[model samples]
Target: VKKIISILQAARSKTLQQWKELDCSITIVANEAKDNVRYLYTLDKYFGPLAHASPVMMEHIPSLMNTVFMIYCTSPYYNTSEHMTSLFLKITNQMINTCKTYLCEG
Candidate 1:
């Protein structure tokens, strides 16, 4: 988990740097998105299963959520490919279910 956080932090830095380097016109160009789904997919792969998550992991949720939101939520939602949209829904539903189970178990 710590490694994941470290990676995410590094990615966030890189993304910010790239954003600063990009011109205002390039940001609006179509089909320039590269592996935008990777974030969503990788997140889904790991966050897909939380049934055995330790309480300690839950404690990191706030910090991790903020990092993830800054990294991913800033992207425009409309440009997502169909595949990404599907994965997004899957991940969203999976997370909702995990939250329900986690809270109900308490």
Candidate 2:
């Protein structure tokens, strides 16, 4: 879990730096981040059901929930396009649902 968080944090920081250096629009940055997340989700073998069921991961549920809520609440500020806004909301909802499922079922 710590390694996952560290990797994600590093990716996020790199993304932000690249966004600034390239002077890309917020929508582009958001889309890139979303794509990266989608790619990560595809790696279910690394974070599948058994991983979620681990005691260490289960203990972090509250922290994960808080992070998800923060992301959902702050997404609008980063969304500049109508399509991106809708997509962001959809993704956020999915994340929240996943977190809820893990917390409740684990």
Candidate 3:
């Protein structure tokens, strides 16, 4: 679990770095792995616990949430995939609930 958390944090940092370095045109490269709803489920299941248990993990939540929202809003997946769309909605709702719980407690 600790290993998974470390990897997730690293991935988030790398993504934010890439977002900062990208050019203005904003070209969308379609990656099947990233577009998969199952992957989102995996992320939620793995990271959700860490977020709940560790303050350090919770600290990255806002940035990670923003990055995810921006990606989904801008990606082609936003328009397509009815099933995955529902999954994304559920994931977002779960994320919101988690954030609320943490924020209120903190």
Candidate 4:
């Protein structure tokens, strides 16, 4: 969860930086936007701080990927790709049934 949060924060930061480079005050060439001023303020409010934290979040992807791979391997039959499709379906069904049983019992 922490890794995921970091990744999202980094992405938000990068997006903020790219947005900041634009001239928000420029008038639209094709259509005169009625809320151009409001839009500029909104853009500043949205992307300003997120740009700073982007790098820290991006640095965590490798560990996060490893964790996901580990979880995906939790299925006993995940070792081989030959039966991967069938194995995935079976695993999903088992998970669903387990959840249903637990729900009923609780």
Candidate 5:
């Protein structure tokens, strides 16, 4: 899990670097690998900053949540893509609401 968080932090940094260089003209569609072992804390660490830097993060909120959900969904203990996607949306909506709250408060 520690290693997974480190990798995700790296990926998040890469995404920010790409966003800076590319100016987000292109959509970065990521692929899912089987048995992904990423950690949620790593994602949480990056989400706030990434969203702060890029307003478009709000647009792809579903994809972001899906990425995290898929990590858990791919586990051997419970392989559930449908439930993962559904939960992803639920979480995505909460994230969006949080973002909206922050935007309004600021």
Candidate 6:
């Protein structure tokens, strides 16, 4: 679980780096991954195994939440790809469902 947290942090860092270095020209966005939407997929892969995990860590949740927001909002995934939108919702819902306590101390 600790390792997973580390990886999510790395992914979040990478996403930020890509966003910071992004180059846009109306036709396309050129960066490290070339498509920021890919971050969602990357995060989804990890979030899958944790869907049913007990005691999900709060450390990872914020990293993924922030990274997902950055990609889904500033990138082309914003209201463009319903597929990605569904995926984003799925992953976020997974987090919210699994880590409800962290959302608010209840």
Clashes found in each candidate (C-alpha, N, C closer than 3 A) = 0, 0, 0, 3, 0, 0
| Candidate achieving higher TM-score, 4 or 5 | 5
- List, residue by residue over 1-106, the lDDT tens digit for candidate 5: 3454456567776455444544333322221232232344435654664446346656666656576666665555324677467656666666677678677876
Model 3 weakest lDDT span, ten residues long: 21-30
- Considering lDDT, which of the candidate structures 1 and 5 is the better prediction for this target? 5
Model 4 local distance difference test score: 0.43
lDDT of 5 at 96: 73
Q: Pick the candidate with the highest lDDT.
A: 6
Q: Which of the two, 3 or 5, has more TM-score?
A: 5
- The TM-scores of all predictions, comma-separated, are 0.33, 0.28, 0.33, 0.25, 0.33, 0.39
Clashing pairs in 6: none
Q: Compose the digit string of candidate 2's lDDT tens values, residues 1-106.
A: 3454456567776455544545446557778788547543433442343244345544554654454444445554432465446654664565566667777986
Off by over 4 Å in 2: 1-53, 77-106
Distance from true location, Cα of 35 in model 4, Å = 65
Pick out the ten consecutive residues of candidate 4 with the lowest summed lDDT: 42-51
Question: Which candidate has the top score in TM-score?
Answer: 6
| Candidate 3: clashing pairs of residues | none
Model 4 CA deviation exceeding 4 Å by range: 1-82
User: What does candidate 4's lDDT look like per residue over 1-106, in tens digits?
Assistant: 3454456567776555334433332434213344333323332432322233343433443544454355346534333465445544553554455556555665
Select the stronger candidate by lDDT from 3 and 4.
3
Q: What are the clashing pairs of model 1?
A: none
Q: Where in model 3 is the C-alpha error above 4 Å?
A: 1-47, 50-80
lDDT of each: 0.52, 0.52, 0.54, 0.43, 0.53, 0.57
Q: For every candidate structure, what is the RMSD over all alpha carbons to the true structure, in angstroms?
A: 15.5, 15.3, 17.6, 23.8, 17.9, 17.1
- Per-residue lDDT of candidate 3, residues 1-106 (tens digit): 3454456567776455444434222333335445655335434534655446345665665755664565556555543567446756775676677767777887
Q: Assess the local accuracy of residue 5 in candidate 4 as a C-alpha lDDT between 0 and 100.
A: 44
